[model samples]
Target chain A: MRIGFIGFGEVGYEMSKGFLTEDPQAQFFVYDPLYEKEETQQRAKKTHATLFSDPQSVAKETLDVLFVAVPAPFAEDAWRSIWSELNEETLHVDLTTASAQVKQRLGEDMLNEKRTFIDGAIMGALKVYQHKVPIMVSGTGSTSLIDWGKSTHMNLTYAGDLPGDATNIKFIRSIFTKGLSALLHEVMQAADKLALDDIILDSITRTMDKEPFEQIINRLISSNVIHSQRREKEMENVIDFLNSHGIEPQMTKATRDKLKMITQANILEKNQGDPPKDWKQVMRLVNCT
Target chain B: MRIGFIGFGEVGYEMSKGFLTEDPQAQFFVYDPLYEKEETQQRAKKTHATLFSDPQSVAKETLDVLFVAVPAPFAEDAWRSIWSELNEETLHVDLTTASAQVKQRLGEDMLNEKRTFIDGAIMGALKVYQHKVPIMVSGTGSTSLIDWGKSTHMNLTYAGDLPGDATNIKFIRSIFTKGLSALLHEVMQAADKLALDDIILDSITRTMDKEPFEQIINRLISSNVIHSQRREKEMENVIDFLNSHGIEPQMTKATRDKLKMITQANILEKNQGDPPKDWKQVMRLVNCT
Candidate 1:
């Protein structure tokens, strides 16, 4: 089956690789501005994938599926504007963390064009990309596509046969995962400021007592070190949720503000790199003093 | 051992009953303006336990342990002024859900007066009172008092030997427990407006996909009906924390705003009863339509 993918960044690259792993003979069409990045372009060539020159060219080439794996705060208006430029109405799958409202809106337009729209929000990290990452896909035309996804080794779960179902589910669950990670970062730092580090750790363990807040906290810190930039924006959304709840987000507020402050201070080894040691050391040691 | 409890309210009343059930003969010098309605007071009269006239009397009279089950949003000036009247440096234990800062400030002042201040926070519903509810206590005075508590039938867990430890621990856990409850309430209402209740529920359960958010959402909705007013205030704090993270909280913000609307509608029987519904219905149904 010939499949074409657009915007081969973090998620898209992995997805195209997954299809290749399933069937080496699977002819693939991929396009990414980053294909020029060191070894990426070579890997695309080695996998026997054709990198398309433009969206129109990619659309002209008849393909089994057109996967859209792009960054969220998605290009909705831009997508709609450019969407008309494409000539074909093929099965289009979106594997982005988009809002349910956006999916619902896009679903309507895609259906009118006689194409299939599947909201497949990948719930795994980039590491599990081509391997066995579980993707929750929900839409009017979802079940039909899941069969094809299975043949291509995509771990897909049908949340329900509705357009916005999977995205809504992903956002809800994300409230705990990403939101809590951001919260933990703040609280750990608060513990440091108040000089109550040991007690805070004890509380985290107790919070994790018969739960998993401890392990979750560690991963959040690691993720912040890696995706510190995205985390900053994500945490802003989290604080808005926290306020609406009337719960005191003791640490999360500090973490987000501190990130802003660091950025304002113009301290960047890389765009989204972790904060310096002074900040990192804030709650690393849980001492009485 | 004889103990005196000032503030015979929901938490106080229930905790005393647990003490009574554990040791029928345990003496309690109880004091409260609403001493008339206290089941503990009535039961104490039936069991012939001693009663004190006032807060001052409890301290002056023969009382081994002093349990201050005061309502929180504790006034710093008022608490300090009244606490100063104690004169005697007795075994003072506070089991109020006061702010961590309040606990720290008060703990320091009490310590200066050579008083053993144990920071204690109740860890379960007030209904459970004594039976299953665990008490988390921590402070410089915790070791000695926790020993006394163990000798007598107090359900206590020493969080750490530090001032303000217990409240910090409780509030942090509340960040998840009560915070999520409010978040759940908001989105459930939003789902109602969208007419996708089943979709949201299925998505959350699937996305939450076998984690504490499932059990946490279950417990918050099923049992612990936090006062909406308190929930509102608590959500504010969580929101402040989320703002620090730079993440946009969809459900949490929706939940928070809806809760404000719930507060506005005056759903609480007297405008201050348990939240609009038991958390279970809140999680499964309440605004879920």
Candidate 2:
């Protein structure tokens, strides 16, 4: 097997190392502007991958797969530099954390009858999962990569046939995960003000770990829709308490605003004072309003 | 034992029913403005408790415990209506969802060597747990109520000797749980726009359910501190994606602002470019800035 990497940064280095573990005889080629950097050289030596000064040479190698692992902003430049030199049979996978629109545009521009362009989104922490990090791919070429992934021991999931479906899922997922991190940061700030950091952490941990994620999400959304008025009052009290302790409650303020919005929307009355069975119903009702 | 309630609302009704199951012979007294309502009357008769139109009568019953379960705005009125008539031996448990400052003020005003004032905060859904709802109490009288709670099969935790400690804990916890609900609502809005509600929920559920709560929190906080710049960029992409889908991205916008704040604070440089070992360190660093 032969493989090529357009950018031998952390991702390319880690993935190359992971690939070598599964296929020891597989030949590797890499192109990176920082190829002369000691760290980059060390990574290339460790993976025993040949390094090149430009992307065109790597693309011309007629490899089975060519991964574009540059930063999001530079992804197009990398693609533009290599596409013209790539063989028809080589799978071109773009793994940058670009927006779905950008990925879709790139996939559309690169579309051809014989050439395969896979829009790939790394879904887990590469530092922890390395090459086996869960990767979701969408586009015309995703299925072929999934079939080939069987021997490479890569964790790959086909999201959809659309070029940007994988990136769309990832971006939507970030709204929850990143929003959660921001909320945690604000909570910790309040906990510090109260000198109750340990206690607060323990309390929330118990609450979150007590139920399955689906159950917790359902209960929160349903209860939120049903009791928005009551929760709005509770949040006012929380905001007041945090303010009294000299802490600025940014995220808490947003939470209060959200609860107030729900109450003002009259969702409880719309639902006849019954809590929704799941979050999807809550979304539908709220969105309809 | 004689137990009196200053309010015969949902909380008082459920708790009285729960108490009877444990101590069938326990005497119960109640007082609320809504005592004549059919629902209140039904609950009172079902629990075999006598209802009084005035709080003074319930207070004069020489009860072992007197629970003030009125709404926050009326908590002071209920307390004033009954305190002067209460026997010195009765424990006064304030279960209103009042502000901690209000609870502390009440506790201070009621403080005396002979009388016991307990600031009680219900920590779970009364509708679900009913009488067994987890309750946290703080004040001079909390330990005594905890002792009595043993025979009643109630879930109770002692917070501190300070009057508002339980309320403070509950309020701080709201910052996290309520913030989470708001985040989920926004995410669902975006998911609805993308028509990826099920996929997004499944993705987040998998991420959340894959780890223990403490570990998840630690990872989020630490990684957030370390990679704020990268995450800020990712959030920008998310905002663009959500906006393109016609969703407002309110919570996602706040999340981006928070990440920008962290990056602007130079947390990565301040932390020597390493992720904090735990959330506490992240809190300390962010707070220092």
Measured over all alpha carbons after superposition, the RMSD of each candidate to the real structure, in angstroms, is 17.4, 3.3
Against the true two-chain complex, what DockQ does each candidate achieve? 0.06, 0.68
* Residue pairs with backbone atoms closer than 3 Å in model 2 (clashes): none
Interface quality of candidate 2 as DockQ: 0.68
Candidate number with greatest lDDT: 2
Candidate 2 per-residue lDDT over residues B134-173, each given as its tens digit = 9999997898899888878789888887777888888888
Task: Tell me the tens digit of each residue's lDDT in model 1 across B95-121.
Answer: 776665677888788767877777887
In candidate 2, stretches whose alpha carbon ends up further than 4 angstroms from where it belongs are A21-24, A32-54, A80-84, A109-112, A125-130, A264-275, A285-289, B21-24, B33-54, B80-83, B86-88, B109-111, B127-129, B264-275, B284-289
| DockQ-derived CAPRI band for the predicted complex in model 1 | incorrect
- The lDDT of model 2 is 0.84
Badly placed stretches (over 4 Å) of model 1 are A6-12, A30-44, A52-62, A68-90, A95-115, A171-176, A195-289, B7-12, B33-47, B54-63, B70-91, B96-115, B131-133, B187-289
Instruction: Looking at model 1 chain A, report the run of 10 residues with the lowest lDDT sum.
Output: A280-289
